[model samples]
Target: MTGKKKHSEGEIETVAPAAMGTAEWQAEFLTQRRLDKARISARFAGKTLDNFSARDKGRKMLVHSAQTYVSGFNLNKEAGGFPVYPKGLLMTGPVGCGKSHLATAILRGVIEKGYSGLYYNSPDLLRDIRATFQPDSDLTEDDLLEEVTTVDLLVFDDVGAENATGFVLDRFYLIINERYEGCKPIIVTTNLNLEELENRLGKRILSRMLEMCEIFGPFPEEDWRRRNLR
Candidate 1:
């Protein structure tokens, strides 16, 4: 619904009123489901841009990029008439460089903004897809694919960590390609360098990602996890 407001300068402006009643309840319900589907583990559940440790200059820059991405995301545009192809983020770096943390933080931010979001570790996502072939499995391949393709945002973590089998490559391409064709956005975190990732996921997938995403760096070489253990 919309309402008209009279301005002090004698101008009338029309504005959309906030959702109420069933609309409000339904919006919250869908938001909750998106949060659950994100499946962020306990380790990263509390990770947010505000809490992300950015002690160093590079880290601070990365955090700023993430914050800017989230702030620029427009759910209304996504749901509007025009076909909006949202730009995604690809965070590539060495092990324990906090790529996953930043990705999760971004996902949480978008989900809280009422846009649907999903998070899946690359290997775990493939395993779940493969399981759909089991006769007694509750999920079908289409079901999984539909969710990944239609969601407003998808966070795919550990991109090159999955085994590069024929089936894996086919399904991986399908998911990425579908999202690409639909103009949906995705957030990816990977430990593999460009050469290694191209080899693991193939040139086609890498090319699609390059066009669709804004690449974030080969972060600090030091392993933050190892440092924390010391």
Candidate 2:
């Protein structure tokens, strides 16, 4: 079996594999293909760290934080000779402080390094989830939940930017809770401070985040957005 059969070298094998006709196999193949495409697309998408400027002092600090996160990251690191999960980062500050820029940078870098990552503007994510309830929509609630929960790293930008209604809060909590319990990392950028996040998302969710993330920033005095206004 180690060597090719000399007699068969001239023959062309044309039979289809039996799996080709199986619906389960076909669906799995398509799902894997779509995931592969998504990973490639994410690597090329805009707002990545490379494009984010480090000119301003505040932006530089944000960049430094992101760099530190990426540099120190080792998905397979061991603790006390036992494999351990990595903690994520939580970026919270006022608007215009390069939070999203840094978060996206980290996200893109992780994806390119062979880890799955996703960036979602918090409000837009909620809106998309709501849209899926339309009569003609294809994605179920569980499907969206699974995607958010399973990504290796998730950049949840603008965490409290949306109106924190009961339904939105519930959906958001589900994703956060699942990821937290599963030891998955989530990079979150919020316009709200910890107190405000606790107020909006409640103490339980905030506590889970405290356990899972290293909190960074409230660089309240830094407004890079205003510096670029033309």
Candidate 3:
């Protein structure tokens, strides 16, 4: 029997008779869930570790580390066989340095391993939380917080881009602290340097993040976008 499946990009795929009721079928279902819950954007929909450019030594190392992290990921615990709290990756780099691409690729890998994952652009997440206050909105703040905190993996992209108001700070603290307390894994990407991130997110959140994640890079400042333009 043949079946049609609609992919995240709205493309249709023919599921062969051999794939039906098999591991591939299950994986397809999980992929649908990943596309919906992860909320990866169209621009990044095509990004995968295989396609990420790693021509330079620094970028090659970054890609290798990402691949290792994904391969070693465990749904019940941290990556790399750590029996302690679930550790994650903190990818710090300049804008256009491919941090988000790598972050999304990691999230995709984790989800494909039968674990649930979510990807949220930090500012967009805060904006959604704020929208919950509107009378017409369908979701509550707790609902959103619970979704992020309970996911098997969470990719929080552009960590310091949101405005640092008290409200924003409190919400961010709650999300990070809950995940930290739960020993859940989180992948964070940001352009901010250590000092700048500390200033933006405050010591409390930064401390928790430092404890929860392994630092990846202060990647070279060469902008891929600029290179593409040249």
TM-score of each: 0.83, 0.76, 0.88
Q: Would you list the rank order by TM-score, best first?
A: 3, 1, 2
lDDT, candidate 3, equals 0.88
**Candidate 3, 1-230: lDDT as tens digits:** 58788888979998867767787787788787777778889888889999997888888998888889998887555457766555898989989888999999888888888788989999999889989999998999899899999998999999999889999999989999999988898999998988999999999999999999999875778888899676
Clashing residue pairs for model 3: none
**Rank by lDDT (best first):** 3, 1, 2
The whole-model lDDT of each prediction reads 0.86, 0.76, 0.88
Could you tell me which 10 consecutive residues in candidate 3 have the lowest summed lDDT? 77-86
Mind giving the per-residue lDDT tens digits that candidate 1 earns over 1-230?
Answer: 56999987889998766664477777877777878878888889988988878899988988988888888887456446664666998888888888888999999988988788889998999989989999999999999999988899999999988789999899889989998888889998888887889989999999998888988754778788798676
Weakest lDDT window of 10 consecutive positions for candidate 1: 75-84
Candidate 2 minimal-lDDT segment of 10 residues: 35-44
**Top lDDT model:** 3
